[model samples]
Target: NKQGRRQSTISLSTGSGEPISLSMPASGERRLAFMDLLLKHHINGGELSEEDIREEVDTFMFEGHDTTAMAMSWIIYLLGHNMEVQDRLALEVDSLFDDLHSEMRNESNSSSTTEITLDAIKQLKYLDCVVKEGLRLCPSVPLIGRSATEDMTISGHVVPAGTVIYCFIYQLHRDPEIFPDPEVFNPDRFLPENSGGRHPFAFVPFSAGPRNCIGQKFALAELKIVLARLIRHYRFVSLDQP
Candidate 1:
């Protein structure tokens, strides 16, 4: 996927005739960037065509920019109205960071530094639960659609091939059978002790399957990092009347 234009070049022209090039990144310099990965997939003949790469890039931009921001907004709103949950999550984040700093101090003998790496974020267990419950309560994408690839019988109803199936994520997440007191913003519902045997499909905010969102992990990591930093620095308060 060298930007050197070795194998192929693709571009789109605007009404003004200005070409927008899908310039490839330099070779052997994969920096874990999304565009670089998309270009690599395209240049390496890895099942992604030029058009597919274009669509993927567009989708990635939208999801990364908009939906993830929406998720954070909803999580902050939930935390605002529920200060108890916010305080508890903040405590978890603080404890983890303190321990991380202590480890750094011991390693450095005299100096201590903090970095919010994946390992550090993983220890913020309560923060993880808070994000999950926020998503369950207010999914950024409230619904997802899929088409049946083959004929299937679902609870006596016949679903033929190519039949479009739509999943209402909001309703599914609020199923009283799956989530007791569904309207409540209880992050503990996602705690391992309380979530021992929940259905896999009970909470699919991003939809579950092979075709599921590719950015889910990256989005969650971003959420944790941003939320961790925000909660540590400031407390959110809802000024609106409930």
Candidate 2:
């Protein structure tokens, strides 16, 4: 707890109140609150080592902001180009709850009690498809680079140990065989019937395997909430100047 407060104080002082003026969410506060709870319950007697806490906090901020911002920009661009898909998405958003008044009441009730559930999100299949397809088209990070720990052979090509390998997610996603008319912005491609037979790695906007993103659920939830609210309020139209 002291360490967290110290870090926040240092950040504030070093920036001459610029960081505080930015008024970003106090991630420092969240960490401190969690640590306080742990101490109160005797779950953790000692503080997290400074290095460990800093690394974890850095990782969280990088992944949280970068990935979601990129995904949102791509989704909005996709919607701008594909009016039909955007219209369908707007309709789905509109039909999700009974009406605006009912939805407001439900939101208030839900806020007071339980957090939004995965089940509620699952019901909005169309919105999900839009997000998934947008991710496929413009993955936030286009390529994933990894180094081989040991020598490996694939398709008669031997990769020497310590060789750096680049997996081109963007190219893989646009492969004609995997995605018919790959250039088109068609969210229906993510529909169960269409996506079922595809190789799992064929559509890895969040990547695959154990190291895959841990915040995929959080990102999806944020997208759904934002899209639902935006579509219900004002319609989007591309500016002529652009």
Candidate 3:
């Protein structure tokens, strides 16, 4: 009734007359919690129910934390095995600092504060390639669930409507034709020259098309920041090295 989209009923009933725990306190602390926001919206005649609120909150917490943790762990492990790559990344980060300080030295004629800002971090082209390669090798979500909306033929196989499909990202990433020496940890593989003329779907760590991960950009940026900081200070060594 509010907008074009149908809103869930605020009246706490699970359709089967079963009691659902969606207790909203009258007044409490500041607007910090999800439940607080839900209560506010409900009071304002917004139609999202307790289950809706809970499900949304759970998705946010679970998906955000778990996936990011997995990606970071994999990136760290990959870096450990590839000291040369880590060293190169660190050098690039240092060069950025040097460039910044040089510009400041010319501007104010004194040493400047060398801090990595979001804008500056985004400019790290080599680092960007490294992270992309890492993601291609070990996507946090190794598989994505999708269903066909219409009948289609893929690789000569007719896929009927309503057919549930699981795209194996990990296996696809290792396709020898698309990625030669697929098991190798080569950041250069993601370089512009190498990536050019390649199939777009060949390297879809964040999935592809309209249903691709909504948090891909945020997650990649977070990964870059963390990896940049870590590489700058510590030289991670492989424990398996004899």
Candidate 4:
């Protein structure tokens, strides 16, 4: 019970201990419990060992929490400066929840029983458009690096093998052909009519293909839930000049 004693000691040692204790959950305890569950289920099994779990936890804790927090910050900043977009998002969320509620009633299910289904979240097209456009404008990780496995020719220039390549996602997102009038904060660019014909690599916020993020879906779902809840409760202020 070292963890319990440590928490208790920390709680008693501080001047503003009550607030600190209230503000922060016992993360150590929570993490241990999560690990116990994972071990019980043998979730990682042969794919990962104890050391692998440590490394994965380190990577995920840093990448997942920091990147998502930064993304949400950018989204808030964008929404604050774009009233029309915020209004549209709010309306979309309202309509989706109303429809979801109706569907639940028709199915004779409790609200808790009717979880946020993939189809339901997919139907939040406008909200999804806003998120896509936000990522296009201010991607969380602005740049990424890769090393060449073999000699390659890019733009007719032959590059030696094992060369480090820095891909600028910011510049890619600003390409005129890929995103017409790319500087504009227009979510309509992600509309089904406009997006259907565009090149797939035009938007690589979460990178692309096999090397892409495994938590992309989880991240997007978390974002949508937070945004939907926030919009339903509060109308965001637009701080930009007309």
My TM-score estimates for the predictions, one after another, are 0.78, 0.73, 0.81, 0.75
**Model 2 per-residue lDDT tens digits across residues 1-242:** 24433222112112254532111123345644543433333323435443454455456566778778888877887787777888888888667654544666677865232223456557789988998889888998789988899999989999999999999999999999989999988899989998898898898877788888888778878877777666667666656425
| Regions of model 4 farther than 4 Å from truth | 3-54, 102-119, 240-242
Model 3, span 112-224: residue lDDT tens: 88777788898898899888888889988888888899999999999999999999999999999988999998889888998999989988888899978788888888888
* Higher-scoring candidate on lDDT, 1 or 2: 1
Best by TM-score: 3
Ranking by lDDT: 1, 3, 4, 2
Per-candidate total of colliding backbone pairs: 0, 0, 0, 0
> Model 3, residue 31: displacement in angstroms?
4.3
- What is the C-alpha local distance difference test score of each model? 0.86, 0.71, 0.79, 0.75
For residues 1-242, write the lDDT of model 1, one tens digit per residue. Answer: 34454444656444598867766656765554776677777778776787887676667657767899999999999899999998998888888888888988998887766878888888888888999999999999999999999999999999999999999998999999989999999999999999989988898988898988888899999999999999878999988836
Evaluated with lDDT, which candidate comes out highest?
1
Off by over 4 Å in 2: 1-31, 34-51, 99-118, 240-242
Q: Give per-residue lDDT, candidate 1, residue 204.
A: 93
Residue lDDT tens for model 4, 1-242: 34442221111123454432211224354645544443433332444454454555556675788787888888878898888899888888788878778887878755533355567777888989888898999998888888899999999999899999988999999999889899888999999899998889889999987898788898898887788778878877756657
How many clashing residue pairs are found in candidate 3? 0
lDDT of 4: 0.75
lDDT measured at residue 128 in model 1 versus the true structure, 0 to 100:
89
